[model samples]
Target: MNNEILPHEEVINDTLNHFSGKFENIFHQDNYDHYRSAIHDTLDLVGTFLHRNDKPFSGIEAKTMKKMVQHIDLNQKLSSYEEVLKEVDEIYVQHATAFHLPQYVAHLNCPIVIPALAGEILVSAINSSQDTYDQSAGGTFMERKLIDWTAERLGYTTESDGVFTAGGSQSNLMGLVMMRDVFSQKNLNHNIKQDGLPPEASRFRIFISDKAHFSNSKNASIMGLGEKSIVKVPTDNEFRMDITMLQKYMKREILLGNIPIGIIATAGTTDFGNVDPLEDIANIAAQHNIWMHVDAAYGCALLLSAKYRHLLNGIEKADSVTIDYHKSFFQPISSSAFIVKNKRELRILKHHADYLNPAEMDEEEIPAQINKSIIQSTRRFDALKLWFTLRMMGQEQLAEYTDRIIDLTKDVAEMITENQEFELLTHTDLSVLVFRYLRSDIEDLNALNLHVKMKLFYSGEILVASTKVDGQFYLKFTFLNPITTTEDVHQILNTIKKHGEDFGTTN
Candidate 1:
């Protein structure tokens, strides 16, 4: 039977009959118990896996994974739901990266809060689309309220408005799109939205810090501005954008007859976690009448922080801002927003459809969210997670959690600086630390540190990330878990040092 292959039509008919009852059952009060039981069973399986070990990763290899996947054939039917569930546990849960584990300090991933997780379940079960008012109902109002709440928290004026986005990259794209449309219409007297871009579009440029995220360049390309339109401004020794250099570059571009469209100041860079001087940069932008957009995707959580909120003093002055709750607010992935100081400017993205949001409406009719968002239709209820979290835990609680992670980062930085074998590259700007393992016996220090990272990853005990600075490799620790302790970081450093020492001896 294992070797005998059935015909496609026969298999399809058999498959349809196998789970006919499951699909036919409606999700009503009569079947509520059945739904509850299924949910518990699924969650119990995942909960068991998460608590099974303290290791931050699974040591599954590619060849073994290939063999495991080969057995799950669509032509065959499982005997019971339990069998299919068991297969899912083996194939997915057994090999997933455990970001909640304390030893996993690779990227900006955070340990999610409980309220947010609960919100995720409710959001999925209800399946709300925030695209139009009639489709979303109260979900539309809830999302807008949260956006206004965030804008007020950032100290923006009452005229501010925003939309929830997929993440930081999407938010960045929206910000740049608005900047492009506004600049082209005001300066070149050309409407890029209707006439497309003129030939002078190639000469239109935006400035960004050298350490900024790659999203800026990708956004440029997406907006028809071309990647060459990005002007990379130099950074200071601390990795913050040098304001003086930015001024000089702006003056030089003006002399060359180049159009300066915008300046992107990063609050919390990806590698060094450095915050650019917002006040100084804002003044320069105001003088040149250029748009100022702040990419605070990783650092916007500071708004909740009482002690560290001063780090982003001039953010309110920005023409547009990007914020990602997933990075620092301890929410799950794809929770973010793009906000602007002038609510009227969002009209550029408006598209009235007869089937959805018609152009003409009765006096009593309310507008749909599709008019304001770059995403025209069918958006997720991602804002509910943040809303539920804020209501359940309160603002102070979230702020405390953010502060705890920041404090742990400082402790990790101090430990690295004190260790003779570890070389600390930059000081703690937020919750990121970049350093490398070095010893006199090592020939190429960069290669040794990179090998250390790989060895630890495959060992399945812990997981860390590496970055390149000035063409040299360095190990990085991005501490986003509030419960992660100094001891955990100490152990990770020890593991890295041991791996480095062993590799040096073998060579």
Candidate 2:
């Protein structure tokens, strides 16, 4: 055969050469220097941004930001990394909410530690998928070790097992799924994994505190159990689930022919940060033969606390539990886990695939995380963040941070209570303070508090969260940053007072 280099062939060869140059951007041995340079440049840019950010927010109006974002042309590729970074700085970094700032007491976001940041870099570059042992190798074992450590801290026995998830919502969903399936199998003699929800599924009820995270209701809906499946037990004056009301509700549900399948005890509520009586709740669950799942997404940090670990005294009795490292352990976003006391319960979510985790592999004793995870097949190696955090900071230092935030929250609560201008709704069991600016002269307190929150956001001096209680609006401060002091909180409260006064005079 004769080979001739035609014009079209030459064009194809040139195009291939051009594409080969792009391969240098890939994170491989051939482009190690390029990868290192890119990472260093990005880190430097981030460091500069963090160092210069003085406020939690930029005070840029939504319309202005939307317009700026619209101006970007994604179709046109940037010529250099510097140009791309400049665009990113202008559109995102400059306007991004600085969660690391002491003034940012708005939400559950925590200021992450340096060790976790380093782990994040390795996670992204290595890009290990924690679905199977073959895919992640040592990463799979590391994740298992972290899970085992967390389980031990939670006071679980050797039978306990868990897998890391994206966030609290996902972890909570896993708990609910386990509860639903286990109850169905035991009670109705039906396998939810093989055959869908049983005929008695509608009658299956899950009890939760009225102040519990909304994810429980959402998860119920996703499971084909309507929102009605969740029965909200009234909370006591301290915003904790009242055992009396819970028992009353359980009895009422049974009388009405509803099967109480599960009870979700909130270890730390979103608004008040108060933990339910876990020991009491666990007792109730045992009496009713209901699966007990502890939603400890916010309060799991107490497991490591030297001073406040006793607060979660009965968590060991929970059948399942949710933990969010991102919120309380100071890890970055999307690091959480759903742990089960009995490793056998995970089989409810197990599935076999010929190309992936076949049934025979189980007999061969191969470890595959996907066997326990229902929502995600290919998962990131997020467990590394917690591993690095524990390895570098150690449990004692991390526990100190938790203790510091809890103490800071108490100080802020006292400060709010002392001020006549604000009403401290309830004391917290964790680090969230729920209160509102008050004025006897102002007839509409809700409207006034709403105005203060909006004004603060627009001013960009401080950031705080707002939530409504019993039709009345209230301001919230979620103290997650250990570095945030009482003085910072005092200043934020004063800013709220100033805004409330400004609104009072004008309107």
Candidate 3:
């Protein structure tokens, strides 16, 4: 100390203390009480909203947001935390839904369980970065094991690999990247990363079911293979992809000399929850030498339940797949995975950085998991929630939870079938059921259904979504809450019926 030289340990200790002090309020242990209470209250609210059990909105809150919110510019820092948080509190007061409420039944979004919430707290506190072994240490191994657990659920025998991502969109993007990797011949012969793809391999094409998530087509365009390059195959009456149409299109496209690079098939379509005929599509992909990627973000939850697992036959045959634990598994906002059968094919992401470890001539064994992930550095350890869900609940328990929603949705569908006021758009094979409010008095029934949906959302006693199916408007009931029941569905129906009967908008 007398020498007036700063010691390295002293500096590190001081720096750590400084950061702990500066970020004290940002993430505090004391906030857990407040945070946990918030989660509980919000979950209750969501439960009410989804099953159409909440009080109708009177536009008071919307007016509040409009009047109170100061236009926020991304570059500007908050003038005061309290000032901003007040607005936020109001926003939540208005927008937050009781998704866990037994009556909540609109969106595919699930009411998250407490165990997963606890995992979220633990993971966020640890802040483990999964970019490298050194970054996450044991967390990397934990995430990989979680991936293995999910792959097992899908019936993958031996060789399977995957990486957890932020959400389904990111997972879908990763799938496209993988297809690009293998098709482009990025690393088979030499260091293709060091040099770009050969000119001949640069041009690419992708295919997706017409009913597939827009993310599939958007991802294709974002990957430099323009949107027009993605061919949309037709689907038959059941809403599953028509294999014959796919074959016809592929043959014609091939005849014109367009290479079939990838095929993206959806397991559960967003509007109808229809599972595509995977076996037929799988056979066609194999025949055409195309990469098969299944976007099973919504229906992937069915794999755990034997009753619903048959809906996704030939899933194991998919070269790549995207699954969203958030959608049906009741995980928090972000938790998705993109997986492939061939472990070695993950080499596409491998590239040596100047700061990265150089391969030692003597070192024989290295784990492929390090370089397999689509993101290069700074990956979040999102697997903890899934791991907790699977290990704690077990697959059977999870399956039973999913089955509960399926049963409730079917009940709601049957009710719709019985009521003249409600017209069934299609029978639900999974959780989501599409229908419309069709009172016999209405001449233009489709327009009335659309009006019912808009009025329902504005009224807010229930929040139901709508979709255009086969050139007509249909209101959607995406039942994902396990605790929901027939009583809940009837409550929503009653609300809709009351609205349908009302002739005046002056409520």
TM per prediction: 0.93, 0.95, 0.85
Best TM-score among the predictions, by candidate number: 2
RMSD of each: 6.6, 3.2, 4.7
Question: What does candidate 1 score on TM?
Answer: 0.93
Q: Each candidate: what lDDT?
A: 0.87, 0.91, 0.75
lDDT of 2 by residue, 422-467 (tens): 9989999899988999888889999999999999898788999989
Tell me the tens digit of each residue's lDDT in model 3 across 1-507.
Answer: 488867999987886686565654445564555456655665665454555434434334567666555564557766554555555656555566656655456777788877787788778877877766667777878988888887887778669988887788878888887776676673245334556544544345677778888887787767667787788999888787888898888887778777777788898888889888889888888887778999899999888887878988899999888999999888998888888777667767765553443454111333334466666467677788877877788778878999998888888888999998788878767888888776666677676776666676666667787888768877788888887789878988988777777634533
Whole-model lDDT, model 2: 0.91
Give the C-alpha lDDT of model 1: 0.87
Highest lDDT model number:
2
In model 2, the runs with Cα more than 4 Å from the true position are: 1-20, 362-364
lDDT for 466 (candidate 2): 89
Error (Å) of candidate 1 at residue 443 is 2.2
Please write out the lDDT profile of model 1 over residues 1-507, one tens digit for every residue.
398888999897886665455753455555667678778888888787778867977878879988999877979888765887798889888888888999999988988898999999888878888888777888988998998999998899789989999999999999899888888878888887788988889899899999999999998998888898999999999999999999988888889998899999999999999899999999988998888999999999899999899999999999999999999888988799999999888878887788887879541377588777885488889999999899999999989988998899888888888888889999967988999998897789878987888888888898888899999999999988878888888888888878887985665
- Supply every candidate's count of residue pairs whose N, Cα or C atoms clash at under 3 angstroms: 0, 0, 14
Pairs that collide in candidate 1 are none
